[model samples]
Target: MASRAGLPVATAHRLTGELVSWGALQRSGQDYLIGHRIWQLGLLAPAHQGFAELAAPYMQDVLFVTQNVVNLFILDNDQVLLLERMSGTRVGAPIPARR
Candidate 1:
């Protein structure tokens, strides 16, 4: 959205703060993105995680075959947590397992 609007960094920061305070966005580290409240409200409609868990094996097989990055994400309060990720290179990136 900032990229589309061509907003300067200060303006973006201010706008993001407003949104976050209003429960529309979440500030995590230096990244301003979506918040957990939205995810919880959406999940209440169909129990999204349970269905995703059941399908994870099939997804993992495809990801393994392709040797590509696979990520499963979850929201925790103001933070977006990575539940799972499959990567071949262990040293180049700063991942939770490596850390």
Candidate 2:
């Protein structure tokens, strides 16, 4: 990790320990993975803000017309991320859904 990051071994170890203490990284067996705090922070960044709200209406419309699953995906870098899914209608839908 130090070589990859171009930082000294001791510096990398100190930074890694601090990040783990701050809930930014977690150890699983022998490997470390991103923790919940990092994921929450990513959601607060500008690129992810309000995307679910802005797409909710369209997702609901698709669900209303097709009565099927509606998934909203965003292409981030090379990964396709599922931002939202509309699978069920409100408790009191105006019209009955098809069988």
> Which lDDT tens digits does candidate 1 get at residues 1-99?
577779987897788788799887887887776787765577665546675677589768856555557677778699775555666434354444433
Which pairs, if any, clash in model 1? none
The deviation in Å at residue 14 for candidate 1 is: 3.5
Best candidate (score: TM-score):
2
Candidate 1 runs further than 4 Å off: 5-11, 45-99
lDDT of 1 at 39: 56
Error of 1 at 82 (Å): 9.9
Model 2 lDDT, full chain set: 0.81
